[model samples]
Target: MNVKMNGFISLVLGIGLLHTASAATHSLKYFYTAVSGDIDYPEFTAVGLVDNGQFMYFDSSTKTAVPKTEWMKREGADYWDSQTQGLIGEHQTFKVNIQTLKDRFNQSKSTGVHVVQRMYGCEWDDDSGATEGFDQYGYDGEDFIAFDLKTTKWIAPAPQAVITKLKWDSNTANNEHRKNYYTQECIDWLKKYMDYGKSTLMRTVRPSVSLFQKTSSSPVTCHATGFYPSDVMVSWQKDGQDHHEDVEYGETLPNDDGTFQKSIHLTMTPEDRKNNKYQCVVQVKGIKDDFIRVLPDQDATNVVPIIGGVVALLLVVVAVVVCVVIWKKRSKKGFVPTSTSDTDSDNSGRAAPQI
Candidate 1:
């Protein structure tokens, strides 16, 4: 279906652990998250571990990652906003605990290096009407400690230092008591968003199409602009058949107003331009029909202006030749006789011509 369901509505319905060594240098480890929704609906959440304001990793809802590379996991960040920063905590006690752990790893108690940890939590109603919670635990070094948030208090069973510092607090107790209520609220919100998604309530403006010759030697381009939801397909067709070879696709980019634009090009030759049989077809997700644009006929192109220019130039040349010929003939008739004998007149009034 090529459905591009960005998590905006999916969150209304729904929604790991590691340790590190001690003695690591003081590096920034940020446990950041953004969560929205209430008790009755699902809460959409994005949790990540960032280092120095740059992303290191994130929990993928689809278990898939973009740029699909070796160090990157399968993760989708479509629901996250790049401009918005999540909350941060100083974690004074956690820092002290990590320093103690580092000391244990080092035979010599080193005080210069420190290990940092960060954690995030979110809850939402699942599609099956069940309340679910998600947590992310992150650390700066390879030998850091892990924190579990499923229970009311954060727990790290290792290195008595971490356990002692992360004792259960009154706030955590209060959150634990309201957990059920929060889950139900998320479920309610999920229902509302689902209805909104299914309702015929949103505006559906058709995409605008434009064509261009990218360069004198390059392909012909078809651009579709101002579409929504970022799900669209643009392709070229030759004589009613889809043309896949010699086609190039551009990434869909967001507009200031949140709409999207994309372009596709067909490698067209001078002969292909003359045929006038190529078509650009655009299909939007959730829309049943396709928008198509056809190539202009050769006669309707700039060739007409070029031909008219040639004809005008020929007319100017012919006019100049005619004027020059007439001037030469007139000059000959007005020529004066060079010899006195040629101009001498006898009893007749007419002048005699020279040999």
Candidate 2:
């Protein structure tokens, strides 16, 4: 018996409604990358899944939604290995087939994500129940393609003859074969993986910002760091207008700790800085508010208090120094030197007043 499949069935029943319990949508993806030259190689192949529009599963060695039993793992690994060989071999017939699958998946995911967005906005549920689907992609040298299982269509960009042959094959035994593999067995595995990932994936971390100046006159840079969900946008603005020129954008990259970071710079001339204000704005997907950083201006409002404090401090210091000097001078002049001799009068050797 399928242990994982039984657990999925029990979960749906225990939750009362599959529509409410199961993910609103499911997606399976196949990724392939290969290089060719004096040395030919198929570098990597991975299968991934997305549930309810969130990334859920990606493993290079294992097939999606497969049973975790030792026998099944070995079998699934062998099957994927064979599939990879079909993609790598020269003069292969499966290349077009693979490309078709990739195209179908690309189309599905592109459209599927949109559907989920609409579902989120709807007031009431259609109650049509939970749905599952798979998308496939293949990359060979410079070529890329996709296939969507839901639409039973190919998205391979290739010669007409090759595409035509793929269409014919897909309509025949390939159709039944794919339906069995994806809809039935693979989906069971997808459910298993989804359950495992639900508790494990990181979510709901906000980004932090750091600002720095390159030089006395160079542009200011804003670095936004430690954000979850890789899709974040960082932009620069001046006096309420978005400035595109003299702006350098850095690619968003993953941090070692599984978060993401991005940097953007805005160049403001001396004249511009004197007249207007600048702000850095960051927007993250699923975040309600945008993160904004306004450039510090030495305008009257800010500079007045600072200048006033400095002047006051200087005045206090000067006053203290003047008082000390006056006191010391008075003490020195008033000093009546005691005569060493008993009867010696006051200022004889001290140089009498010129008056």
**Each model's backbone clash number:** 33, 18
**What TM-score does model 1 achieve against the real structure?**
0.36
Cα lDDT tens digits for candidate 1, 48-77: 211111123232233221221222222234
State residue 313's C-alpha deviation in candidate 1, in Å: 39
Top candidate on lDDT is: 2
Give the total clashing residue pairs for model 1.
33
Query: How close is every model to the real structure, measured as TM-score?
Result: 0.36, 0.45
lDDT of 2 by residue, 1-355 (tens): 1112111111100111111222233333322222122222222222222321222121223323232223234334555444433323311323334344435435323221110000000011114534443322222211222334454544444342244436534564454444445555555555554455554332546899766664547567787877755557799887898889899986554444545567787777877877887788998765768899787774534421222343353344333220000011111112221101111211011110000
Residue 37 in candidate 1, Cα distance off native in Å: 36
| Alpha-carbon lDDT, every model | 0.38, 0.39
